[model samples]
Target: MNQRVLAERARRAIPGGVNSGQRNVPGLSDLVIAHAEGARFRDADGKEYLDFHAAFGPPLLGHNDPDVNAAVAEAGNGADLCGVGVTEGEVELAETLAELVPSVERVLLTSTGSEATFHALRVARAATGRRLVVKFQGCYHGWHDSVSLNVISSAEKVGGRDPISTGILPEVLEATLVLPFNSSQAVRQAFADHGADIAAVIVEPVPHNVGCLLPEQEFLRTLREECTKAGSVLVFDEVITGFRHHLGGWQAISGVTPDLTTMGKAIANGYPVGALGGRADLMDLFSSRPGGPAFFAGTYNGHPAVVAAALATLRKLRAEPVHAHVFALGERIRSGLTEVFDSLGIPALVTGYGSVFVGYFMTGPARTYDDLLRNDANMFIGYRRRLLDHGIFELPLNLKRSHVSYAHTDADVDRLLEAAAVAARQAGGEVQDLAAASTMGGAVR
Candidate 1:
């Protein structure tokens, strides 16, 4: 069936024609990809698109990377859900993660980033003997009750207990304190008011959830210092920035180590895997031996095939110049986007680090979620639709960020720039001379 028909049929079985809420939004492209390889995916209708969403930021090596697939196949040869003892693949993955992330001394695996963050918070509470958890307003740790509030709330409800989903206990909301992102003073005030009861301060380092607003160096340093002084565990939720920003995660680039780190996404090259690692003294709480205070276990914590895929991904990252290539593509996209928008007399701001970025259709930089709210959302959504029409697939909505993958080539970058130029012209009501704008392609490069 075609994508629109498939979606309509899915709605009869699923809640909104999609399992993920982001995929069910209005005005999104009606596309159901049948197969993906390298930098593009083919829709059911046999149409191809250059993918910029990168499956919501997990396909760092792109779709169906041969090396990662081979490792998965090899691990699955004799793998079983024995559920009796540890697997060598899990141990090796742990060792690899420990060596890569500077803050991870010991590790525990989970199946999703949400579970990893939940476990990290549990360990923090058990170790600190406190119940209060502090998180930045715009930052997203996961969808769990503990860190779910304030992620996509309206401006007035920014610091309030507005749960992303219904049915969360009000008590769960009470235990979390939501503060504004990139504000050191707010962090200090929150810590001052409730430092003695604060268990952990979890942040996204680079809060990509709300379209990639960066943290000022002083803000992160302040978090590290304040958490240290107050005895509160600082958790860097690097789910989005883990290996995509740098080999060692954003914490390494920021030079501020957290007491706990939650990572997923690019770690397994789109496989189902999540990990929480930090100070051994803290991670040891998950120990099953007598006297351990915290509990964390998952049925598929380190499935052999998934762990093998993660190991293969990490090893390949170690051996290849993947970061340099992706970073260059990201920079090119950012600059090219700016040029396209400028040529059409449209206001835009392209911001992000390394392989991730978002284009906001507003003037000046967006430093907070509230700032992002100022964007012309309808125009941005229109621009995304235009890109899709031009065979450049980005996640729908203005607030969602886009990703550039290792599989994306210079030609892919050039094509995306060309599409953006055309999209921009269309959005600005300047499409009458699209042929002339298309001829101005070299300007973006």
Candidate 2:
């Protein structure tokens, strides 16, 4: 019927109907986006929707930001140099990031978040000579085999030993001990049991996997202390949280300097760029000399143009106080949504920090994977559709995360609030227990 219809029809002839699952918006069957600028994108169907998803949390400067685009274009004009040599853009980007994140004395750039996470693990393992990796449930480091286990899996599906995913081999989940988030007790117990053999404790500084789950109860403190005592490296996967939480990302916002941190997304203003940086001694594990190992390298690992885009993006972020605008917008969005939920009596709450948030509908604060499994999904499903109908495009499905960008305007905020009003009206005007629906799907349950 339309370009999106034709595109989907044509793409089904291929594999995933879409290139990567990143384009998949859960609740709403989004059409192919034709063009995006600022906080709006026009789909192939010619519908202009306000984009709250913000390219899945990158696009902090909004889509096709002129500054980043200009930098990328200028760099491309130079020599199409795609090698592992020191480029001006790369050096500037590294220095800028180091200035923002004081703990990063050295940095290694990668193509995507997965590559950074994968390399971080290798560095940790090589540095400590430990084989096991400890991870918390519901935290997604990447699609990598080692970090894929326990991510979005319920207490039932992956509790003992059933395959949680179709393609992941069983061996991948064996050594990974999935512990609950925000539980100091679990961390201590895990450390006591396998302290000597564990390589690192990798985590999403804020678990946006199953909604916006934040840290509490000295959970981060325990991890820091235990890893310091146990000779295990502490890695923070700031791929999503990087540059969004603050210019310094989660470590700066949380006041916790992870031994190693993986960052991506907003660093390059929606261009593909991921980086891993940490303590100087640990990053040296990638040296070509005899003592160190060489695990992190790719053809486009430090592509000049992308590095230039990142450099420009970082420069703009520093020069302009846009984060203040985003912080104000985030507070308004969160407050507005909470008030609407209250007035409509919908069983929902907005959980978040700074510019990132999630419309988590449930009782009290969601603290565990089991708790996320118990939140309302049906309501969010219906609500997502209504919001789309109103032309406010946030994640429709219960994606466990909502996002805002530096480009989101006051008008956009008003539109989002109006859309939430419509969605809430359809949600029976009040919050209700979604535990029953949560039990149906093995993934979230």
The global Cα lDDT (0 to 1) of model 1 is 0.87
Query: Quick one: best lDDT, which candidate?
Result: 1
Per-residue accuracy of model 1 over 306-425 as CA lDDT, tens digit each: 899899999988899999999999999898888888887888898888888789989876887778878877677778888888888887775889998889999998898888888877
Local accuracy of candidate 2 as per-residue lDDT tens digits, 273-338:
999988989988896334668555688877888888898888898899878988889899999999
The C-alpha stretches of model 2 lying farther than 4 A from their native spots are: 25-30, 158-164, 287-291, 429-445
Weakest ten-residue segment in model 1 by summed lDDT: 428-437
lDDT of 1 at 223: 96
Q: Return the clash pairs for model 2, or none.
A: 27-397, 211-400, 344-429, 345-430, 345-431, 346-430, 346-431, 347-430, 347-431
Model 1 residue pairs with clashes: none
Give candidate 1 regions above 4 Å deviation. Answer: 287-290, 430-445
Name the lDDT of candidate 2. 0.80
Error of 2 at 384 (Å): 1.0
